[model samples]
Target: MLADFESKHSLYFDFAGARPLQFVNPPQQLEVKAGQTARLLCLFTGSPPIVSCWIRNKEQIVDGPELWTENTDQSSSLVIAEAKPQHTGYYTIVVRDRKSSAQHTLTLSVIERPEPPASCPVISCVTASSLVLTWSGPCYDGGSAILGYAVELKEQGHTEAGDWREVTDLCTSTSYRVCAGLRHQGEYCFRVRAFNKVGASDPGPVSPVVRMEQRVSAKPQAGEAPKRPTCVTMDSSNKVKDHYIMQEKLGVGKFGQVFKLTHKVTGQVCAGKFYKGRRSKEREAARKEIELMNYLHHPKLVQCLAAYDHKPEMVMVMEFIAGGELFERIVDDNFEHTEPASVHYMQQILEGVAYMHEQSIIHLDLKPENIVCVDTTGTSIKIIDFGLAQRLDANTPLMVMQGTPEFVAPEVISYEPVCLATDMWSIGVICYILLSGESPFQGNSDTETLALVTAAQWEFDEESFDEITDEAKDFISCLLNKDTRRRMCCKEALAHPWMAAFDSEDLATTKCLSKEKMKRFLARQKWKKAGKAMLALKRMALLSKGDSCSSPTSPGEKSPLSPEAKHALKSLEQKMQGPPHFTQCLEDQTAVEGSSVSLSCHLTGYPDPEVVWLRGEEPLEESSAVQIEYEEDGRCNLVLAKVSMEDANVYTCRATNNHGETFCSAKLAVKQ
Candidate 1:
């Protein structure tokens, strides 16, 4: 029976040693999440069954609950279950047979999952149609940090019950709203859950049924905020030029400048906001802007078509509004704003604001500047700038007062609880200026203006309002009321008599703004535009000078490899040779401190190789002073900006491909 088995399975034996016993294949590098089973296998030639053992860090491993061993005549495997970080590192398998013995090594990496949230999230407040939820972080990190949280809602009464629908929006903030897709007066239960890399925990204990119409006033509870994704950083490798043709910069926005970009295929124009997260708040603010624009859709709002999370920064592409700011047309060189036109603008503004409020979004910054004109006709208005926006219950006291001072409400100045009425006050200020061409709360300086605003000091300028009607004055007064509760919200303001006359024949023909008023408005706007531009320029200068470690290549620039390097690589494929081999290996080099130098390597081999310039195993950072130059012939050079003692290291130029890899290294010395 044994002789018959040997005759049938002769492929496993090396008869007469036709080929020397050798490793046909060996285990490769492995990566796995913690708690998962990891198995490494190695194949050998000519074996009845080789005695094999697994070793980590030179220590022989033993079989147990977390580890097991398996072997066949030709191959062997070492298995590790419930792998942990300690299991990570270099591991080797030694195999011995009657003919010969072989040893193979590989690397294993186990990633640890983050722990669940330290504490459960709490419900902050609820309004007629919205429910707000907030949470703090988990006590232990587990291994990975918290990525984001999900707010789930379910109706209480059910036999089998439906699945929980997580709020599907881009926001990663501790505070988020569940107003959409909800019935106005229905009773719904909510649960807040947090998740990390490994998986999610069971939803926190469910909450009592919340009626949609229930009104509650509350502030953000004090707690340890979760480690949310506040910043999305980037490097020189992130580029947008491949698909976009950047045109003129529109202007600086709340977080960064808005650029005019045209698509490569469609040739369509759009405004793109490219932001670098220098501060955590800046990153959070940018994230919120994207989240708000992602789900909002209205004729009165600038549409965000798509967003690109291009590492190093986030790029938001929005529908381009061509005409520019509303003030631009309202203060045109030959501007004439008819009362009907002003009414048209205001109607659109209120409709936009009404829609925003319906969606539980508070436009904290509302002013003539934030409103944009769709075209030169002043027919369409779009609201822009949402830097200070937030989602809150209708009556919640927002202690943080942030908005244009001239337009801020008295409640804001007193550091009291603020609500949607704060936005109404700003709108009122905008309307007052639009009708009278004189700021109702204008003062000598910001301090005096703020003081006057706090006192709610303002009156109709007799000369400016001589021709204005009482209905318009009444509409403005109701919104400017210091008692926020008495103030007319967008819905009520849109129903005023003056607004009712917006479509009348006579009113349509009467120009609301005179030539003298427009000229002054235009001058002030020009100054503001100039001031904003200067500020943006200064910011750009600072960003460029801030990172001195390495100067980065312009993301827009093309590769700078030399033609010779290109030729070498192309010729290598045609010429018969082994894997990439270095022709001129790097040599020891010395440089004077503060002096510049370049190190070059000449290489040739089959299948063009990708060469990485490195200091030890660390890749180099491209900067203005230090650059890596390449040629088609596989020649690579490292150019130093200014060599310093700190720059001394063992420099290496490693080239690799499918077949094999070759490297040439040398010591770099910088003298005093």
Candidate 2:
């Protein structure tokens, strides 16, 4: 029979029908920013679906750093996270089975940073009301072409102080004939800067101050009035849309939503706060914030690295200061930083503010929420949110009400001119909260809060202050003084005696808080979560009994729980000051087809461990046959719902933490 089949070709029937056709649909072309996630999707259809293998620029991929693969009944995917430029190039996916195979290919391009321009502007001509500027391209294009240039002007002898004010719209060409807005007789200086799709380049040297000379109206000099370059007022990063990849959204407000952003090439994480330009007021705030961050850089300040303008939406890629908000530490019951620790944190705050003031940038909004711990140690702090920051001179009058009501200075509430002193006032309030964990001006209502801030209606509560020191009180009073003249600047605040002691020897062992206070804080934080969990369970129990929720499913509906569900909801209520133990074991369980069985045990331990249910030495994450869940006090349940023969196995309950591990195992026999 084999010899006869080998001899015939055209006589063969439709065996295995269509030869198990496999079709692959990879993207024709894909573009992703560097440092973002890249996903390659491949799908197939046949009697027994497709098995796939992925290749990049010709090398087969495997489970390794930055690469992963997942497959389902009919689809499969390759995911590369924190993708880099080296990951770019040709990619191919081959889908095959016993009878047939097919392949799909595509090109991936990862956008990266362009080089900053190298040329400084040349002053070609100058007149009473205009200046003509010309420039050459950069040393490198930073992987992209130069898109535009920026022109700014400032007075010759101001405060080393005044920020450079952009005078032209982003010019599309190398030269811009700066027309209009020049002082007729006043001395002035000008500078030129360039930008590309990636980001802005440093500005070239400023032109020497020149007294404007009148130019009589005459026949235009040949090529004098060249075509004006189409200039846009927005930064190049804002105009060009593709440089950065938007990742997860973090929050939303009337200002706009915030997101976690990653720089495609560098893989740096940033907070992208989107300020909706849907309203003029909001847009102006966004622009001001960008302008402030553009020039300011300091260790204590949250750096605004880049800005993107997705029209009607503006995004700022800012520093991802890791430790979370200062308020969290304030509320943490376990946070028991003594006077020495508290003083160290305060000193850093003042140091950061000093840097900001030195740059002539005033953070109009200063509060616990706006400040964050930059490092895990929680000692290093960073100031965030320049949306309310302004480049104000001491005499610049503030006109609007901004900042948290609780932290706003008296000068802000009165609509008086805000200066560095205004921020110092906020620091005083922060100092108060830091020491005693109490708000100095917070009230029950917005009206009351504003009133308290305006009137400087705050005092050191005697009870809370007894544990605080006189030097600390003096430092707070000096900064919080309603009088702006005596208000301590960042330098003076840093020099305060209370802050000075932090630098003395033996500060760390000096204790952050009084012994009793430290213990109370730790106890407060540890038990709060456990207590809340207990309260929720009680409410759930009462609701379930009242509603008769234990009834079986009527029909065509999925049951809320399996018959074997170990609803040991009451087990975790007891506090565990002892080592974790197995109160209940798996204990040979028997269940019928389509029924559910649950196995659970109560664990007692200090500091909960990661609890897992395993089969032999293999830990189970989750599956259609089994699931794992736990309660606050360390009681965990392993539920095997919809029991089938495949569910038969020995299950183990294991708890592991920094301390050690404890486990209990039992068997389950499922009958079909």
Best lDDT among the predictions, by candidate number: 1
Q: Which residue window of length 10 is worst by lDDT in model 2?
A: 563-572
Give the Cα-based TM-score of candidate 1 against the true structure.
Answer: 0.45
Task: List the candidate 1 regions with Cα displacement exceeding 4 Å.
Answer: 1-239, 333-335, 393-396, 507-512, 525-672
Q: What lDDT would each prediction earn against the true structure? A: 0.66, 0.63
lDDT digits (tens) for residues 48-97 of candidate 2: 32356666633567767678988763676788888776776667666543
* Cα lDDT tens digits for candidate 1, 1-672: 433532442111112333344567465678778889988887876433245666664456767887888877577788987788677666766655444445666778676654434334444356667766544444333334355566777765643446667765343555567768778887777665556666665566566676777754332122211111121222234345655688998887557788998877667777788887677777777778877763345578877655555555777667788888887677666666766677778888988887666445788889787899887764778998776777765345566546665677777666667776788999999888888777787665555666677778899989887877787888898899886756777767888887887564775467555646645755664444433433433343344345323676653333333333333333323333347778899999999999998898886654455566677666775779778776533467889978889889999887775678888999999899
In model 2, which regions exceed 4 Å deviation?
Answer: 1-241, 330-336, 393-396, 514-672
Clashes of 2: 18
TM-score between candidate 2 and the true structure: 0.42
